[model samples]
Target: MRTWIRGLVLATLLLPAFPACGQGGDGTRPSPSIERPSVPSASRRLTLDEAQAWHGRHPRLLLAADDVAALRARRATQPYDRIAEMLLRRADEHMALAPADVGKAALAGPDPMPHVLQRLAMAGLLTGQRDYSRKAIAMLAALGEQGYPRRDRSVAGAGDLAVGLALAYDWTYEFMTAAEQRTIQRQLAALATEIEASMSPDGGTFGKLAAQEGMAGHHAVALGGGGLGLMALALRGEVNYLQSNAWQTTAEACLRAYYRDAFGSDGAGIEGFELTLRALGAALPCTIAMRRMDGVDLASATALGSVPAWAAYELLPGPSTLPAGESGGGLGSQDAMALMFAACPDNAAHAWLYDVTHGSRGRASFGRAAAGDASFAGPGAGDVMTLLAYPGERADAGPPALPLGKQFPSAGLAYFRSGWGDPAGDAVVAFRCLPRPHLGRWHLDVNQFTFHACGWGWAIDSGPGWEAADGEPTLTPTVGVAAHNLFQMDGREAAAPCGRTLAFVDDKAGWGLVVGDGSHAMGVTTFRRYLAVGKRDGRPRYVVVIDEIDPAPAGQAANGPQNPATAGEPPVHQYRHFLHTGAGNRVDLSGRVATLTTPDGGTGQFAVVSPPEATLKVAEIRTHAMGTHPRIEAQHATAGRFYFVAVLVPRAAGDERPIAVRPEGRPGPAIAFRVTADGVTDRVCVLTTPEARPPNGFGKARHRLQLSRGDLTQSLLFDLEEPGHDAPSAPDSAPGATPTPAP
Candidate 1:
């Protein structure tokens, strides 16, 4: 009882009301009281009569679980380091020591531990055995007494206690005589009175909907708590217990706020992935319960990503793209949790539970073993547990593509899907560039990237820990936009620059973009495109194109004698390009394209080719030095060197892109290419001008001649003109033209 109380307090105090519901009582329906229905817990899998009935109608209905032995066994063998094992051991010992009292269940972390006990209780009930119920109830009572403790708030104790009580009510409801129900009622009645002390105007009082510690780590907890609270009531089934006016008020407040304000109108999870999963997983059950009693449907709640996080985790494997860690932008243990979550019921909600099972240690500690011993291996095995799932349908039409918010930040990443399912395929493909290693920030490099496919990360970003020979960047910045291959300016490095200057600015439109201002140029990448298709003509191709323009050149004062190597007047105009590759096999840069051909003849390319029949024409065609952030130079003018990525990706039919021809005789899927003709050139451009003379009588007349203007629209117009022709009023193109390939 003590433990149960503690757990409830901890969970509630950790996070207050649900974010899915808004705070005010607009036209939205009133929130309902939390209630639970008795559910059986049995060793053998059995569907409840109610569950079957719901599934018959909804088809996508997800029933709650009551298999304690199975869940316990699965949880037991999960790989745990010393700290995690100690906590589990302590929980088990405490449960054994006070088997008669339900208060000891608080032995585990406040928010998560009680859920474990609730699961055990539900399983015991389904087995029609009093022994399991007795043990479970005692654990809850013990937990209640101890009261979940945290350095922060004590109300969270109420949350864990709530879950333990709900599970007890849900699993033991049928067997409990009226007197037994009273015993449990007496325990919970006292806690409900204090809930208001913790409620915030936004439903975040006591930290529930609030960013607990911060928006980045465990942001999901805010949303996760609401689902747990609802689960407590649903499993309990005691109308008297759920009908408490205090509990009902909290539920109403939380629900209204969640839908109205917490999530965006378009469903974006501003708190990022952690909260997104937590909210959705808990919501599945809450939505179901609410609709059954009060006619409220939260199924349409939007904060969900287009493809769902688990699906992406099962499919892609790159370090988080977000600034948290270098391993890729997603939650660290997402891979393992995504796999484990499949069996829980609703695929998306199941994914959230999978991660939560890792407990206080965080998802990085989650492992395949936690998913049970069924051996989840096969084609798309660990990737997506679609065996009992529904395919997503686009609201508009066509195959369901992930929404832009979901797709872009999560786009073009390669991750290792290492758990169950087919052993033959081990790799996942995300066709976007990775940030180069030496860049200071974690911003995706404009042109650098990573590729995953065929059970391996073939074309990949060199991780950021290399040590330079002379205390400089051994590789590109592990941070910053220049680490990626979107584009560059006057050869200046983005993030940190030497010869030139570049930086990334927010996009007024819904996307994130890069901005560059160099010694001789200023340019902005206006748009970007990522394309992927089955190997066309037997070639596997993924292409990314960035559209950029430099509307003006730098003033002479900014460029004048910055250094000896740069002493000569800057070039009138310059365009630079960068092409990175996943397959290091064989690469070539020619005309307006960069191509990588696997040893088996499969290919991927970067190119600026005519896209069917559009009125726009491409002109100036040439290849120059590899474009990238500044680093040590072999030659005074040359900085970074380019090389084709080496032997990777096997040669196999149905896995390669089909070959095709272009106007320049270039092969299919250009990895990196550009053309600058008379109008709207596709090549990356860099421009420079002398600084302006100070206002004074001694200023030289030639200082006025240093002015130059760079125009992006003009550059595009230039590309439309015929090739082999020079700009109408400019000098010939400058040196360093070694047409290389993108590897």
Candidate 2:
């Protein structure tokens, strides 16, 4: 891909820091500007001649020169990357072609001008060559004349410029004549100015490299802009840079803030894949250049997990598995991570690089660059997955393979995924709760959870998708139950005028919190709910239950409401199912048994009996006041090879009652199971009476069966192992096999 740059932007640095927000106890604010460390003497500095010679000797850096020539000879018979292989092969061809006499019309297509110049400068500095410097300068001049196209506000602009300057200065500073050096500096000055203007007024630059939504965009913009901005100024003498504290303070403040907020403590970028690459790439160069100037180490604040390997680990698709997307063209998250790791394998970030690149999938495409086409030449068997498969190097340690997917749901009905490395291993729990969309009016999902993982997350909040139809923010997680799987009255997604997250707590080792109530609460409907995580003896388990008591049933109720200003209810309904996004064995939900349907159509019932507490009252009302659509979906599938999971809805002991079964037929006991294990489990029962006095007072009858369980394993007449159609007839008291009268 051609490196694109727009215009010779430039600007002076600004500074401002009043109240010292640092260790400088003196009243005045410390310089927010990053101080670049002085380079060791001239003998150690890389010269232009040295850099160029290094490139000529290292053929791999040219991507695939020999391969391209060979591919061209057999173009008709070779594959797509062969063509991309060829384009890269002759990058020198394009570089030598020369722009049609300076005044010519601006050429269209992916311009390789900036890339060629940058590459040449790197080569020149490494080899200490004069010719490379001259060639690179010529390309830079052409690039400046074209006036780079405007990029949607981005962090890349500043970062790229900073890198370009550093390389250029490092290689050519000593070799160039007085006139040449002046010209080069002038060009850099202009670029610096333009980047400064586009930088966010709050302190970073803005430019969209990928889709302009989600955590990815924000991370890219901040780190990209911050790193680049710091480099440009740090390289220029600090005395020549801004003296005001505000400008310096703002830049420094944002650099740390963005790195911390977006990247997280684990070094994981908030947005997945693409953005993580951009942020890390930009941050790396900036970190290097800044440290070269200043003594500060950003790595101390950022962790090892924040590197490209973290991204790669998440991207790997196990052997024989198709890539995650329905369409395979988009960059695989793992591939991007591998590439970045190869480019920047410093000791601090080496571990992640080694672990990811060593994975089985990564081994297949090591040392391979994007061939401008899908289905390119893959990696060697051993080198393919080696963390250092980038030809010239190798990362230590074998690649780490993470478990593709494993999930668990919380009490407030919030869902979470655990044991990324293995389905059975203990894992971090995050929230998955969303707000209702009322009459098309949008809001962020509340009661959302954020998982804390090994400095990296295999699964994360998908983040808000502004473009999504419901207008519910994706991936912006909050803590609490008001906006989760549990019920909320009058349909409030945000809960209150300015929703706030209530108190949340979890004993790190024992039970953990799935939801809380800190956010605002609205309307005439609300429930006090709690969930606990504990091991029944040694078996880990989660228990959840919600208690809702509606004092005034008179208020309007809707299935989902859209507008709050109005006085009506919205039409919202709740349903649960275990969704399958990938190819996996199917599970059947028939009567009280959940049977796993293998890849072939054969059936194996894994769980046994129990019915759920079904309340039609909660489903009947529809709110139109807020144009919100409220809904809940449950997705079920086989768990742990085989295990029977019986779910119950009857209130624990205290609320047992003889609940009426409607219309004469249906599973009546308040218990249900999503079995994924062997052995039979019995379904037990009890009953409950209305809370307040009914029409006939406390004696009024309502036949609701409270549920309980018994041993169903190793039983003959009631074997759960039998398919639903083959299972023995139920006892006369049970609903389906016997005659049961309606209330």
Candidate 3:
């Protein structure tokens, strides 16, 4: 394939120019004088004969003739009417502004010209407004003439310019003159050449790359494949360049690789929430265009089938997501959701995500001025793609029917919630222990977790590591071990390691647990974290966290002298457990208990039950540009193995429920605790040894857990040799069945 493409490129480059199609050999009918527009020196203008031979249909990229007619027929309908009005208003706004100078250096804010051009073109197509089309053509001419000098700044910038030009050209094709079409084709050809160069092995904006690896990252997949590929599709038959076929083929390959590598099998983006939306913004549109134009169903070949569910799970109580990687938390774009619905119209979850995040009557409208207000739905409300991809009408099923907890094993992230759709009543927890290789925007935050309840982010991540203030970079104290809720050994940051999930069990009756092996992350032989959430009366009540650490392997004396600096003395490592709270939250420490109070008057009690001699303190840490926030530090030193058992309980503003925590009797190398809240007492026991047959009630087991409350008891067995075990049925419960709800 490579050889054939290379031959085609070489053949085309060596070919001579031909006369106009209608002109005879003796030049009976003279061709119209071709006026070449001022463009970059490297640009090649297609001759009149070449432009005349290129065959293409009008409005072929995103909309067909029949589809455009349907949109016109539905212009007075419910959703379409609202969306059409928004587009017309935006197009009017675009008419008042001048075309951007593409030759200037890139600015700090996002270039709005692309979206502005898209809106103008779409409005003209839907309303048959000559004014809108003419305005869009003028902008298109300016873009083609100036040739977007900043397109080489980043793949994203290049993609934006390519897509803007592609959409304006394709949608407004019928309104453009022969000369305008010729000029636009030359600019598109030049842009395609630039994009191909960036993906080459030689250093470019994207740096060195293999063909497959070039499309592996989310940015490349989004901007390179989806963005630039859309241009190739729009220009495939219209351009004389043979490299157009190679670009299209590469774009399709990028679609497949994006699903295979960029996102997990469970449809979770590795870079977290913000970039996920940005990538899908292009990828989904490209997928829709391919299906519409070529009858190819690329969405079926990828993890897009599960993306709606993943998006639903990532949404927290404040309608925001966790700052997992480089993201600042917010709801995903409505344009992406609309595209997801277009790809999977039969999927109720996708339909619901679209309906719930819709511009007018969705949760996105909360805390905003009014229904049709621009800020209510963010910038996506004004996007033209949302209108094109909108599925007419469907039932909006709430998320209650979906599972309360979901785990993306490929991405090594887990999300658990108590209920759905009730911001004030729901409790959410996000856990990360990525076993896969960490690269490109991923943080060294393995075994980290965040907590949210009562409409407040109780435990939070430190957000992105880098921030710029007034054009100068400012380094924050939040990075690596300093920014996460994990333990550090001997006051030294451990090397980033691949953390693994040992077991996961969700009863769907408000009881669930996830176990992770993070020994390498802690720089120890054994460091396992057991995290669980409990609900009482269909509401979230408490969360339990138990950490077990051992510096030596099994059958070796952990207390033996190992450090050269302390000869003949028992080895001891100072361990510190850290927990950061949300901004403006107050933390008070008393004995081993730390109480957190949110500005909304919600309260959370954090109690450390193990390591009797441990000390707890609260100090302020600067978390990027989010300002100073309190972080709880728990310190303990041990010569051998030890445990850190803690319980967190979240209470609503006025719901004064007494909470108590007591340490239970340990059975061998294990820790047990009993937590009582809301008139229910639950006891939990976790085994820490590699293998044990202690005479205690746990019996013969390793990596075992036993929980009992009232007449119900649950036991889970974890096998280290084989991970990914679902929670096993308790002795009193049916196998492979959900636990019975408490009366």
Candidate 4:
């Protein structure tokens, strides 16, 4: 139990975070120290008759016999070449099963090595087999004689059994024996002395990798200190009981200060981009197997090797994803697209998201494989790093300059797309204003927003991956605030959000905008939210929301007009306004306008133009709704001063053109809209005033605010206001933001 690393912290390269001695829970704690027993001694590095006399040599360990003969001379039909034949048929059906009998898989569990026997002992010693390398060296000598089980010892659950028993005892060191490689090095030095007495003084880590508030400890320090620096770089060579440079310089200086306080540098995934692609499926394969076996360049650590093409060009062209906070699904992305093109294979947006979700068979993939730690859901045994760390390139499958608008201003996450990756759904608009003490799994969805067109999804936020459950994990309810969109008062909800984001416009060719204030997480005196997306009669494609609620000064009103000396304050709250659909939507509503119908067969329409005596309701979800599915709710309440607008149009059925919303001039976000379908008369504009500078053809040269079919002018930037959680740790900055931490 050595583990030091104080001087020249691994000769500099990002080290900082992992000092955390102890704090995150739920993984059953119990360790302050004590536990180390193993006895074995013998050596001849790589024996067994030199592994049958270097069998079919060519320095192959993690794929390389010409990279497995160019992946068995590929037949590239794409789906990333059939995920290289489903990772060599999941290491040939995990070397044809038959291993678990070590006291009967340790009587069902207690650290009996379960990541499918480290993918069939590294797919049977990288395909040479030998009884799957002596049954994974007899389950690492029966898990070091059952001593390495404090219930699978945690240090991020012993990073998949210490990186699959340090890659099956360093690629079957010449095929075992020498008392089977010293009985797997005395069970990896007694599981690295129970992970340095269970890390704490700041490194075995805790939580608050907060994206807005809490519950995300940078994927448990990327799978327990990145499986202790990829099992100390496969136990690089020998030494008195081995300590591989003090656990690779103290787990690369606590993952270079937890990738700048939890994976930042604007690649968003601050713990929400689906746990930032499932913690980069254990941080891009321990930062590409410690940069291809020990060069250790964390590719600028938090640059996170172009975060899966920055999550397929700013969070995959819509249609669901941003299950914020505790994250659950979609973007399960084929083991983070084979660990980011096998660690940046010249990346063309990670080979265009491995040609869009690996040749979709309606994406069900062997029925969610075994889910657990999502590296492209099992069955191919959790994407064996897309065929032993894919190097065989596809490089530029073309197209990637990406950005009609991009803003990760330190994970508050903002986006705007009209084209880039456009399959029609290029209008992938988004918003999440994250500010004040909000994250720790906060789904109190402050200034939420989402929209997709052409690429379908009209308006979504009913996140948490349709209530998870396929193989395991059924996490959908990101807790209360009714699965997101915003505004809920009397019934409570926004207890302490913080919300910011005031102006952003990428009106490059048409319109794209974002404006939010969420007035101190909804206590309300003026909680603005103006969202807009373009194209209407050039062929439907539209979205416009402009809620402006103000009612607090001793409030009172069912419809405005009579104040009578601020009469006995206190009873005028009720704000309700959430929008979640997809329980196979078919909604109808009417009076204030609703009209939806998707579930594959499309059609849309939404309306409710202001406090003209507000009204509208659709309701459904809430049997303890954790996230979504079973929602159609529209709601619009009025108890005092008012202003609210909603309009989403995609209307296709027989091209009937007639959409509406009107009430322009003074009321917070004074609104306007007018569409007349094919005959032409589009004038969609969501302009709120009392501005403070911002609105000059939406930034960057030559583009003016007046684009054709209207709908995208955008406004409301009260100097980007953000201060509530009452000093919830100072927020409100826009030129590359980042000042969070308040859950």
Whose lDDT is greatest here?
3
* Candidate-wise lDDT, in order: 0.31, 0.31, 0.61, 0.49
Give the higher-lDDT candidate: 2 or 4.
4
- Ranked candidates, highest TM-score first: 3, 2, 1, 4
C-alpha-based local distance difference test score of model 3: 0.61
Off by over 4 Å in 4: 1-161, 170-174, 177-180, 187-218, 225-270, 274-276, 280-355, 358-384, 388-426, 431-445, 448-540, 545-743
| Evaluation by TM-score, superior candidate among 1 and 2 | 2
Prediction 1 TM-score vs. true: 0.43
Per-residue CA lDDT of model 3 for 1-743, tens digit only, reads 01000000000000112222223335465322211111111113334454345466768777776688877877788666766777787679778756564334123224355666787888898898888998888887776677665534577667656676788888888888888888888888888777766654453534242233312545555666676678876886687546676666556655555656556456777666666776676777677777786667655645677777776766666543333333645455555666776777687766665555553425532122222332222223334766676665564565637777778776677878776665445688888876544344546677778887887777777676533223345675344675678887786775654566656767565366776766656556666677877665445567777776776643233654465665464477787888877778889776677778888777777777777667887877664534567788888887776677777877667755445555544334555554555545554555554343223432323455564432223356422212222211121221122323211
**Clash number by candidate, in order:** 186, 152, 0, 36
Give TM-scores for every candidate, taking all chains together and pairing residue i with residue i. 0.43, 0.49, 0.78, 0.34
Worst 10 residues of 4 by lDDT: 5-14
lDDT for residue 30 in candidate 2, whole number 0-100: 32
- Residue range 1-743, candidate 2, lDDT tens digits: 11111110001011121122111326354322222112221112223443333322211221223433443333243232333243334344434646443223123333322234344554444334466666666655555555533222244544444444444454444556666656655665565555544443533324322112111225444444554444343334321244212222333433444454444344443443344444544444444434443444444444434444333323322331111211121233332344444334553334434333333323334323332323321111111112212322334443334322212111112222233333213333333221111111122333333222222212123221212224443432222223333333333343332122222333232223333332223332322222222221222232222222221221332222325686453333332221111123343343332333333332322112212322111111111111122222222221111111122111111221221111112322211211111111122111111121111111222222221211111100111112232211222332222333211
Write candidate 1's Cα lDDT for 20-96 as tens digits: 11112342542221111111121121134432333212111222343334433432332323223433443344345
Question: Which scores higher on TM-score, 3 or 4?
Answer: 3
Model 2 accuracy (lDDT, Cα): 0.31
Comparing 1 with 3 on TM-score, the higher-scoring candidate is: 3
